[model samples]
Target: MLEVDGLTCRFGTKAAVDNASFSIEPGRFVGVIGRSGAGKSTLLRMINRLETPTSGRILFEGVDVTALQGRDLRRWRARSAMIFQQFNLVGRLDVLTNVLMGRLAGVPLWRSLIQHWPQNDKAVAISALEQFDMMPMAAQRADQLSGGQQQRVAIARAIVQQPDIILADEPIASLDPRNTRIVMDALLRINKHFGITVICNLHSLDLARTYCDRLIGMSAGRIVFDGAPAALTDSIARELYDLEAGEVMDDAPDFVPGELTPAFGNVAA
Candidate 1:
């Protein structure tokens, strides 16, 4: 279990994440939903230690995550992989090599510098690519792949990290509708199939309702709601988004509970 006790981040006088607190059990698929600047990204970054917190504690299995340093911090990061909105792959590197980068923390420094990956690591990278149906593009440059394909490659890289949890920050924000379904499905599969905990920041209420087992709603850097998706009533949603009912409906016209957008095409192979 992961415990976030009164976590907070302040930039000068402004608090980006203000006294946020939550707990996540292993293998749970969670969505953090809020409007822009609500500090959803900051919360995830703080958990990953990409952003330093001003107060409170983050504990993982009885260990204080906030106090970790140097090698320990690096090891913690290795265990908790992060996926970003923009697919952050090396543009010039081959797909396989990019995935193999996940193993850098565990490998000897000289071996990684020389690109001398162990056979077992190679096999793991290949297996991750195959799982995402990107094995055929293993030798292709990351920049050459389509947005959807690149995101898939990014996910494959995360998988090869063998992370206990994945922190996805608006992962599908830039993808087309078709690719959104594909990437979201891939995340769902990773959670259910491999039992990896997934904490995702999402802008689309439809997608959050459809994919997440639990939802954490934020407004102006504060956590306002936390419950199962079904419990998130229309009125609560309006408060979370700080919008009128009509505006909420206008934003999510196709939001049928437990269903993805019907217009999305099949997953690309």
Candidate 2:
């Protein structure tokens, strides 16, 4: 389990994430939803230790994640992989090499510098690519792939890391509708197949309801709602997004409750 107690992040006088607290069980798929500037990204960054918390404790199992430093911190990062909004792959590198980069923490600096990857690691990388139906593009440059394809490559990289949890920050924010479904399907497959805990930040309410087992809603910098997807009514969504009834009904079309249309096809598991 993961425990976050009074987690807070302040930017001078402004609180980016205010006294947020939550707990996640193993293998659960969680979605964090809120409007822009709701501090959702900051909260995830704190959990990943990419951004230091102003105060509070984050504990995984029995380990104090907040106190880890140096090698300990590096190990923690290796265990918890992060997928960003912009697919953070090396544009010039081939898809396979980019996936192999996940093993850099375990590889010696000299070997990595010389591009001398172990055969086992290479096999693992190829397996991940095949799982995502990205094996055909293994030799292609990351920059050449479509947005959805790049995101899948990014996911393949995360899988090769063999992480216990995957933290995705607005992963589908920039994709087209079809690509959005494809990306979310890939994430859903990873969670179920590997039993890896997934904590994703999403802007789409329908996607969150369709994919996540639980939802955490934030407003300003505070967590205002936490419950199963069905429990989040339109009223609660309005409150989370600070939308008036008229705005919710007319202005914010995406806020209305609806089913997420199924993807054209599932990526290979």
Candidate 3:
């Protein structure tokens, strides 16, 4: 569904993303893993057009995303949602209202200006909240929710956008272990049930292996590994992280997703 070719982003003289190239198949849950400043986030941002590439081409369903400008760029952004490490919710607004903001691309200007969402848009937002068992808290202030809940709200907001793909940049880096499990499960559910292709930048190899079907590893601003979870052997893992084999395999968390909170089955139905 998306292809990035010879992508490069330089800040002054230093390259943040140096000639990185990859492709994402439709509905694939892909994880980009790397250390700090490895260019994982920059790669996703360039694909989403949040950062302009110094030189390269990004194609979404064969559309030249790098060439998009004005309304065209706005349309592309609307179709490709971005979730951040910090839940980017308006702390003062009601949760449902924040979710409704996703419809800004499709809603008329007058309604958006007045913050008056149409009934259909309201229904969509409500349904999205329900997926995460958050319908009851629709009217609560965003700042009042827990970090996990806030992250779920952010996911709902992304869902309400009706995006085909979600680019999550370290979406769980700020959460506790329990909240990390919840957020990761929610993202997996979205990918499995809703068929939204997810490209997540994960710090934990265990989380990436548990949730992503494919793993793309980066080091020094270039792809070092790309393959299935099973293919990410000890040697490759060490190489990807620039560590010895003994130092790399001992840190993965062992969380099982046997019972999904809010019940992914019910959400799908």
Better model by TM-score: candidate 2 vs candidate 3: 3
Name the runs in model 3 displaced over 4 angstroms.
Answer: 243-252, 262-269
Q: Estimate each model's TM-score.
A: 0.92, 0.91, 0.94
Encode model 3's per-residue lDDT on 118-220: one tens digit a residue: 9999999999999888999999999999999999999999999999999999999889877887888888888888899999998778778888999999988
Q: For residues 1-269, what per-residue lDDT tens digits would candidate 2 score against the true structure?
A: 98999999999999999999999999999999888888999988888899999999999998999999988898788788999999999999999999999988888889888889999999999999987789999999999999999998998999998999899999998898767777787888888878999999988777788789999998889999999999999888877777533342342124222223342234332
Angstrom error of the Cα, residue 184, model 2: value is 0.3
**Top-TM-score structure, candidate number:** 3
Query: Residue 173 in candidate 1 has what lDDT?
Result: 86
- Poorest 10 consecutive residues of model 3 by lDDT? 244-253
* lDDT, residue 60, model 1: 95
